[model samples]
Target: MAKPNLPVFNSPEEQFQQLRKLIIERIIVLMDSNFSSLINLLYRADVDEFKLKKALAENPDNPAEIIADAYIQRQLQKIETRKKYRK
Candidate 1:
């Protein structure tokens, strides 16, 4: 047997673009009532600001891989200093 060819994005940008489509596709599938509720019900979502933007921008059905929100949360948390949240 040979190794499978897993889809590997060229860079973070590519991943974000793809992620966005996935998020929106999932959202549509769920007929998401609200953003928070959608987030809560998602089995897993790679929710990044860029991805969210892209998802909301495109048809969303183009991409098929949706990374969990947990991943995005972790990425947003890794920093040397804290940042202020917008109100």
Candidate 2:
């Protein structure tokens, strides 16, 4: 039987780098899933998709800020609908 070959890291730093990369990739996947859910909620609430995308770009590094923007947008949409029907 032939032994399977696996690449070996030569130093602690190299192993750490590999582990860190894996962790970051997993985090990114989780973030994507959460963001998708947020977007869907915003859409169902009648929030503008363009505005949400702009907010995300404006706060590229802050997920909380993006979420706040989504919530605010939903509120604004609700207010607008109320005003429209009150006429």
Candidate 3:
């Protein structure tokens, strides 16, 4: 199979810029809301600043991936909680 070519960003800054856009896009899709409302929700969302900072300190090159992974993990936890409580 041929490998697909992807746009490789030049720097961490570029990667994080894309990451923020992706996070906002996902939030909008999930909430069925506008950019302004989603921005407010993102502000209120449970993104751990401390952990983000720690992740940046540990692996400065992949902050965007770290944050995205955290978001995925949080969503999975919510699904698990709902499943457990719906019994």
Q: Which candidate's TM-score is highest? A: 3
Q: Residue 83 of candidate 1: its Cα lDDT?
A: 56
Question: Against the true structure, what is each candidate's TM-score?
Answer: 0.35, 0.45, 0.47
Model 3, CA-based lDDT? 0.62
Q: Write the per-residue lDDT of candidate 2 for residues 48-67, one digit (tens) a residue.
A: 77876787788788655465
Candidate with more favorable, higher TM-score: 1 or 2: 2
Q: Write the per-residue lDDT of candidate 1 for residues 1-87, one digit (tens) a residue.
A: 233344689998887767665654665555544566665554343346576557646644533333344344545664322454431
Candidate 2 local distance difference test against the native: 0.62
Question: How many backbone clashes does every candidate have?
Answer: 6, 0, 0
RMSD of each: 9.5, 16.1, 10.9
Q: Give, for candidate 1, the lowest lDDT window spanning 10 residues.
A: 62-71
lDDT of 2 at 44: 70
Off by over 4 Å in 1: 1-6, 32-87
Over 4 Å off in model 2, which ranges? Answer: 1-36
Cα displacement (Å) at residue 42, model 3: 4.8
Task: Record all residue pairs in model 2 with backbone atoms less than 3 Å apart, i.e. clashing.
Answer: none
